[model samples]
Target: MIERRMNPHEGRSVINNGVKLRGSGFCIHMFYIRPVTYRGRIDKGQKIGEMLPMQRVYPGITSHVHVQNCNRFNVTRYL
Candidate 1:
């Protein structure tokens, strides 16, 4: 499941989106992006969302997506 919401942690206008993968042992929250998938079973490599235009929001700032694990553990080992 994916839901769109404002995330003050990112910024006053930044969006904090959520993607819940049930039975997969983890969930992910995507910051600075807009969700394309609201609710459904998504496969690997499927398009779930797109990065927001941060350049317009924060001029001269780096444009990137912030992916965080809801489990509060480092996922670098899995990568």
Candidate 2:
């Protein structure tokens, strides 16, 4: 599942984009990056999207991606 919704934490127009890899039991949430892969099987090392320049969205914040190893069934536990 790919999430493209308003960030609840930010409480603004900021979108929280991310990909939930159910098969692999993990999810990758990205900030300041545009997602290109919408619906399909993503292979390893596949180009999911282009990384946006951090200066535009978050000034002074380091450019990086947030990854979480989660339980596919539970959806809350980070294991």
Candidate 3:
């Protein structure tokens, strides 16, 4: 669904499930939704592009760190 900002200065945005997004302003967050199933265990999951946002105020340079680790289960047992 497309969402319009109340103030035009802020700019408008569009969001849809499992779809990429684009807009005029800086993208602080970008992600995707997907279903994960492992060993008959199923769950809804989100894939985030950026785990943290970094911006330089003086130079007006903005950037984001894209997370690459996709490991969901790392079990440890002690007996």
lDDT at position 65, candidate 3: 29
Among all windows of ten consecutive residues in candidate 3, which has the lowest summed lDDT?
1-10
**TM-score computed on alpha carbons, candidate 3:** 0.16
Clashes (backbone N, CA, C under 3 Å), per candidate, total: 0, 0, 0
Candidate 3 overall lDDT versus native: 0.24
In model 2, which residue pairs have backbone atoms overlapping below 3 Å? none
Question: Weakest 10 consecutive residues, lDDT, candidate 1?
Answer: 2-11
Candidate 1 structure quality by residue, lDDT tens digits, 4-79? 3435265355544435444355676666666676666767787877877777767998878877766768977899
Error of 1 at 51 (Å): 0.9
Evaluate all candidate structures by whole-model CA lDDT and list the values in order: 0.63, 0.51, 0.24
Deviation from truth (RMSD, Å), model 2: 5.1
Candidate 3 residue-wise lDDT, 1-79, digit = tens: 1121111112222211122222354221222222121112212353322222233222454443231112322324411
Query: Which rank order by lDDT, best down to worst?
Result: 1, 2, 3
Q: What tens-digit string does per-residue lDDT give for candidate 2 at 1-79?
A: 5543212135443334545443454554444445676556767687766655555467887766655444324546545
1 or 3: which has the higher TM-score?
1
Which pairs clash in model 1? none
